[model samples]
Target: MSHPPAPPTSPHPRRWLTSRARVGLVLAVPLLGLVNQFLGFFVLVLAIVLIWKDNPWEKAAKVVATIAATALLGAVVPDPQGKDAGGTVARADGKGTAHGRAVDAVTSASPSPSPTVKPGPRAADYRGLRLDRAREKAEAAGFGVGDHNASDDGKSIWMRSNWTVCFQKTGWTWSDTKTIDFGAVQTGAPCPEEDGGAVPWPKMPDLVWKTWKTARKEVVDLGVPADHVLADTAYVNDTLPDEGDYDDWRVCVTDPSADSDVTLDAWVTLGLTDPRNGCPKSDREDGDRPSLPDRDDDGDPDYHDPFPGDRNRDSAFPNGLPRGSDGSGGSSGDDDWDWNCPHTRWC
Candidate 1:
């Protein structure tokens, strides 16, 4: 008790850095910022504490040394830019970084840099967007799209706006990662089951035995023109008396006939026959000859043949062609061509 509290064996400032320097010790944590400006807030706070602390140079050194001993260490020097941004360099999103703060602490005489960093979208995000828009987006993200866009159905995409994205692929390595691929297809068309597949085209339907009206509708539905569909048989087809019910008649033969793939504008001709009597067995009528000989013995019957005298070339002419076009028939136009082009192709 005599010793009382003998001053707790007090040591000099050189011996013990005491509570007086505790603030420096704590501030040192942020001053050694190494990662990015990630601890930007901490750095700012450290700078602020320096304003009230004594011997800032001494405190700064202590912090640098402390950090140098830890994992966070790199080329961080005092940046005059820090002073301009109000001694704050790190962003709330952590972009300002611990390094920025450390630099500010070292020599915060200049304004801090406020760089604008906007992140881009990921590769997967490009899917489902319009093809044109997807390319624009990829470019915005710092990726260049020269001519990489292609159709999933293998159809040429002349107008990008008319299609939409369905899938994506990236480049082989990270260096070429921006070389992104987008699989697309026309807006209303379904995506192909596999890339580079062709879309199926519409085909002509079987119309034999069906009423002329039903056959006509089916042809029209297949995209054939209404005016292009004509009655196959002549006897009952000439001109209906309205009450005659021409639509009730059945089709015996078709032009581009049955099951043939056809385009929308292709002309469709249907041979008409009395439903009760049925299709003609032959050009001879009454019974088919297994081969319909030219009724005129000169060329194909004028009946439903689009190219009446051109032999088996059914689609060569839309209007009736001159008979014996090869100069075989005694005359032209309506003359018989059977002299040269004989029965062929059709049953």
Candidate 2:
């Protein structure tokens, strides 16, 4: 019976733990002293001496001397900026090459700044170009042919090299004394009323009795220039005819005369004639032949003498009626005669 009492002598050789191993050694020693800080502070002082065995060893040695004086006062202080264990930051001349420049000056990482651009203004596109190359590309882009505005759908604005642009003003951000406009058209002239439908100009017709190769093909179909249609010979009598035959000549005098209006390609002249001298009369003809002199005693000549100075009134000679100077049917100064045929037909 005294042997069974021997089992009660147990002061602490490690065996009586269970209350769930004293709450699993008081939560596994501060989670194993946050993983390995010296093997979790030597397994947190051996699990606080087996979870304070039966307590009082002077309150379990003052709870393991207050967790070893708070892990020896956080390992004797010192981290001003000397961080280590790979959190880098060491140098105050404690060279590891100033610990990579003190971890490139405190665990490194700064680079941000960048942004600045500017440059606009300078234009000259000139649409279909050619008003003298759109004024040489708007005066070589520095603008100023008094800036610009050309505009000329015909009526010859100095025929700007026979024109072309068609309409311009384009995008324009311009500024070297800005100004633009452009419009143009004539090279074969037309498009202008805001570029839609214009082509009219040609008119100048009646090239007189025609033929200097039909008046130079009607003045080169009005765009003018069968050498600006000049011609000039016109001699009904002199006889100088060795070889001049432009279809035997004919356009008798036309310096803008026949139905006049003018201007398209301008410069006319003509005067040809010599159709063996037949049609050249025009000082506005039609008096029916009376180069003057027949005061009308009725020979029917003062331009067919209607009552030319009335020789007893032949009234244009009705079937043989000329009896003047008192031959009986009535004559002698026929009641004081004074007719003067067709307004004194060049009397």
User: If scored against the real structure, what TM-score would every candidate get?
Assistant: 0.33, 0.23
What digit string (tens of lDDT, one per residue) describes model 2 on residues 1-347?
45544455665545434435654655554555555456556655665665566544467665665576346534543343424534344455644354433243343444445564333334556656568878777777765542222333334457566667766553334333554556676565544455444545556677667677777777777667666767765542222234445565777667777665455557887766556454545665664422224575444434335666766555434433434433344436545322432222334
> Model 1 residue 100 lDDT?
38
Q: Over all chains combined, what TM-score does candidate 2 have?
A: 0.23
Per-residue lDDT of candidate 1, residues 68-175 (tens digit)? 423222234334443533453443346644543423343435556789653333555776788999989887777655333343333477889987886676553345
lDDT of each: 0.56, 0.54
Q: What is the TM-score of candidate 1? A: 0.33
lDDT at 227 for candidate 1? 79
Window of ten residues with lowest summed lDDT in model 2? 337-346
